[model samples]
Target chain A: MNPLKLVVVTAGLTQPSSTRLLSDRLGEAVTRQLADEGRGVDVHVIELRELAVDIANNFVTGFPSPALNAELEAVTAADALIAVTPIFTASYSGLFKSFFDVVDNTALTGKPVLIAATGGTPRHSLALEHALRPMFAYLRAVVVPTAVYAAAEDWGAADAEGLSGRIARAAGELAELMAGRPATSHATDEVIPFEQQLAALRAQQ
Target chain B: MQFGIFTVGDVTTDPTNGTTPTEYERIKAMVRIALKAEEVGLDVFATGEHHNPPFVPSSPTTMLGYIAARTERLILSTSTTLITTNDPVKIAEDFAMLQHLADGRVDVMMGRGNTGPVYPWFGQDIRQGIPLAIENYALLHELWRKDVVDWKGRFRTPLQGFTSTPRPLDGVPPFVWHGSIRSPEIAEQAAYYGDGFFANNIFWPKEHYMRLIGLYRERYAHYGHGTPEQAIVGLGGQVFMRKNSQDAVREFRPYFDNAPVYGHGPSLEDFTEQTPLTVGSPQQVIDKTLTFREYFGDYQRQLFLMDHAGLPLKTVLEQLDILGEEVVPVLRKEFAKNRPAEVPDAPTHESLLANKPDEVPVEAR
Candidate 1:
């Protein structure tokens, strides 16, 4: 059996960022769950901060640099995606949204995703549902019911256990979905046959 | 085995001298470039189509027709004729007239124009670009081969018993080449019709176009047009040449730095490294161009973009002189070596006419 490929994307600007810490926890929980189920897992982490200029240049030139191309290929071909970003101005950071904007709109269709975010306060935590989850839904990804958001206060000793429990629940839900679906390798050569395309257009006419 | 120049017809300010050409000067410059292409030993001269400010070639047929009246052997063509927005009826009539005027030395590249706002200005939605390309080209295809056209499609007004005047020269419509930078659907369209596919190879890495060209080749064979190697392919190259590589780089760095498409984004060095843009000695340009045969198998046409990015008319002419003199001769000789016997040359009016089967007109049908 082919091993499952999981790509974790995090938009953490600084080293030792709590957003990255949240991503690590989520990734570990998913790996642990899948390993316990006797499945091999391949996890690749994408740090969006490193690709800030490439992302911006892609916007300018209408094409991605080779470095950004690799990241795009990895995300599109993975069996599942773990996307985490820090909330900025009541939504995902500009860098995070720009990355997805450059991705083919149909690439994420029917994909399995677990959405997560980190914010300075719990009041801003709902940005995960109102912002990130909806964006994934627009891409037609099958997002899990449990979205894990970690506020800065939630990283304190008082809420550490709470965060971990939420991470475990979301990870378990994601793993269940990944294990159910066969490992995916999106075929780059797949194309709609010209006859079918013409027939469809004729029907519309 | 055709080498030529394609200009975007932009009126940009020269970065080094801070001088901009008037629209009239730029229009005349494009014509001069076309004439120069023939004077120097080149095959084709293709002009772009643009309707917005900063771009002057909104009327390609008029310019090409004028160039036809001047030149003797050069092929007059469009870098791309818009398939999405322009009425295909107009395209059929215009190019057929150009074919007669140019004595069958005409070909066209069909593309869905990329500017989003230009779509709405022409009463089209950019969102429906692919479908519009499909339906309109289908109509254009039938109008040329058949004497009468009865057409109804989503994007245009219905036509009944329309006869586009001036039937194609010798009843062979101009050869069509589908040009695309990224879309795979365009590749499929080209393959389905057994038309040539032109990859804008200057913009992105090779892998992106590799997959697209591979798919086009596969489907070209699947549709029974020919083997993968026999499918016609064309590529776009951007080069600036001098006797010394350092001087070439020094002269072009400012223009490359401020180019409207990719300037101010990446350094000139990185852009050249990642994409097909080459600013170097004649030998460097020749060596890099030969690698294209390795990448895309055996292509038929190679058109370099040497006139854009605000390079002056004098510099562009000098660059073309070096290219036609030093670079292309070696590329032609080297690319011909070890090449398979099965690959076809770029399609010309005479070849297409010879290959066309005997058929009677409306009286017999």
Candidate 2:
């Protein structure tokens, strides 16, 4: 059986960012959960800070650079996504939203996404619902029900209410969602046949 | 293979100095550019149509008609005529008249104009752009082929027993090439009619165009036009060349750094590597252009964008001289070297008329 492909997008600005730490923990937990279900997984991590200029350039040029293109293909080809971003101004970081903005809107249709965020305080937790979730909803991605948010203090706690518990719950849900799906091929790159496009246009009219 | 130049007719301030040409000088310069294209041995010159400011070629046929009277052997064509907004009836009449004036040296590429407001300015809704293109071109196709037509569609009023005047020269409709940057439906439309499919290959990456052109080819074969290799394909390229490669880059950098439409986006070096814009010596331009045939198969026409981004008129004319004298002659021979015999040459009025001998008018036949 082929391995399920997972893409983890981290929008933490710093090198040793807690947001990426949360992303890595969630990714490892998801991998373990999927493995326990006898499903193998291939994980690809995208560090958005490194691609900041590329994303801005893509906005202006209407096309991605080659490196950005490969990253976009990875996100589209994944059976599931674990998106982690540092919360800023009660929302996902601007870098996080901008990266996804460059992604083709239709690329994420029906994709299973696990939403997570890291912030200085718990007040920003609802941002996962108000901001990121709605954005994914607009893209038609099937977001996992459990969203994990880690405040600065949650990283040090050791109880059920801590970041680890939420990470485990979200990872388990994402793994459950991914385990039932087949490995996705990059078939979205294929152009629809002209007859089909014409039929679609005719049907719309 | 046919080699030519196409212009968007932008009225930009020359980047070196802050001086902008008056609209009159700009229009005259466009005419001078077309005449120079013929004098330098280029095969064709195509002008873009725009209804808004900063663009001057709103009436392509009028300008082409004027060029038709001045130039002798140059094929006058449009980079694209808006099929989504303008009445197809007008398109049929204008190009047919231009064909007569140019003595069968006219063709038009159909496109959904890029500007959104132009749709409403022309009494069209921007939301119906594709439908308008599909329906309008369908009527335009009929208007040229059938002298008297009865047609009804959603976008336009029904036409009954209407004759488009000045029927195509010698009873042959000017060849059509559907220019699309990304839309596969447009490619299919071109294939459906066995017309040419042209990729606006300048602004975007070649891979994007490769898929569109590849699909056009496969469907062109599916429609039984010919083998996929035999499909008529045209590609747009842009180049700035000098005798010295570094000098080429240095000379074009100011214009490239601030020109409209992708200027200030990517560095010239990066843009050159990513897109088809070549800033190098004439040999470099030839080498980069020859790779296009490899990417899109053997194409029919190659049109370079030589005159945008506020390059001075003198510089544009000089570039044309190098293109006609240095780059194209080599490209022409190289492109022809191992081209498959089955691939048809770019269709002209004469070639189209020759293929339809039975349809010729009574006297012409």
Candidate 3:
């Protein structure tokens, strides 16, 4: 069986962004949980701030930049994704939001997703469920039940013990999802042609 | 760990020789730095979008689409997707198109933007930035969620019946994080929606962000999304690291003092003291960053500003090497040893979509 592939995506533009830190912690937690579950996993994290300029320029010229293409490939291949961003004005940041606008719509089809956010205050924590989750739902991605939101206060109290527990739980959820039973349908099921059905019937006859 | 590098898009004078890279050179160099970030095992690469003269990231999707084709695992993101000035309908359409192009490794941050004058250029009023942000985002949200939406709001004209095509992958819309520096209202907005709140802790002191985050956590719980501790959070930071602490400071002080955004405003020492900017050795950066949890709590994501200040491409590449090889490993271990199990880690694609109680089929329900 292939090891579960997890991709953590973040959009934190500042030098020391809370969004990046949250993304990292989530990734580490998932890695450790997978290890504990006796399952090997490949974890990948992609920060969006680095790709902002290229993505932005590509939008203007009607040409996809080389960098954008490569990042797109990553999303298409990932088994699961952890998406983190900073809340701005009750929504995701423009930079963080715009980056998603460039991805191929089919990449997230049926892929499992975990939505998370970082902000100055905890009030915006719901942004993950109300804002981010709904967005993923529209894309047809399966969002995990629990989403984590870290406020500045949480960071202040983030002792080693406190932080690790959070990671374990989040990772545990991810592990369960990865180990959960696979859907019993194949891509061809929805597209069975009349002739193909007839042929199958004749063969059965 | 979530490792990646971000650029601030500054056309700076080469301090050593007093020669500055042009804006175009600086922009292209930022792209090279992004690719290099991926090569060195970083997870995500994001850039800022500024329509001003000193910056050149006006079209984020265009550049990210290019990068998406080249790298294999690197997720692409944006620093700011202008919600105040840009039309929500266009935003909905554009991002949907990109979603199809980049697969699903896409998410974004939305903001009113820092520049005050940009409002006029886009036929908007600066005074109404807050209203514009709220209304625009509401529309953008509907555009992504509803297959066919008829929306009328204060900011944009009513839509008779519009559908944003290239429907989100498997019906999952891109994730979002709301970023703010000084706006509590934005934080409230994020909480109201149960979205992510991002505090770009680069310019302000920890206390300021702390207050905002505190309010968000409380409200998040109030809204019944989860306990405040369960809310997702992320932050921003800037660093100039080298093997030697002294050398790191020596090399970065001039750039810190002369760069456009924060140049000549505060002494480097004062800036670092008050803000998230750390211009020193990797250890110093790590030390300062770890302290963040002391003020905030066990957060999820952390990103660094490495390729700014007109630093040469060569220097930026070197920075990524240090980050991937040295700083990240220690931080990962330290952070892991610290997080709490009940607290919940940040959300991921798998975790978010797990155990989704069987959807009530439209017909059966």
Best by lDDT: 1
Cα distance off (Å), candidate 2, residue B143: 1.0
Q: What TM-score does each of the candidates earn?
A: 0.93, 0.96, 0.62
- Identify the candidate with maximal DockQ: 1
After TM-score superposition, what is the CA distance of residue B237 in candidate 3 from its true location, in Å?
0.8
For every candidate, give the share of true A-B contacts it also has.
0.63, 0.35, 0.00
Model 2, span A31-124: residue lDDT tens: 9999998989999999999999888888888899999999999998899999999999888889899999999988998999999999999988
lDDT of 2 at B120: 90
For residues B71-139, could you state the per-residue lDDT of candidate 2 as single tens digits? Answer: 989999998999999999999999999999999999999999889989999999999888788878878
DockQ of predictions, in order shown? 0.57, 0.47, 0.01
Interface RMSD of each: 1.6, 3.2, 22.2
lDDT, candidate 1, A126-199, per-residue tens: 89999999999999999999999998878774554588889999999999999999757565556899999898
For every candidate, how close is chain A to the native chain A in TM-score?
0.92, 0.92, 0.81
* Residue pairs that clash (backbone atoms under 3 angstroms), model 1: none
Task: Return the lDDT, model 1, position A168.
Answer: 92
At residue A192, candidate 1 shows an lDDT of: 94
Q: How many residue pairs clash in each candidate?
A: 0, 0, 215
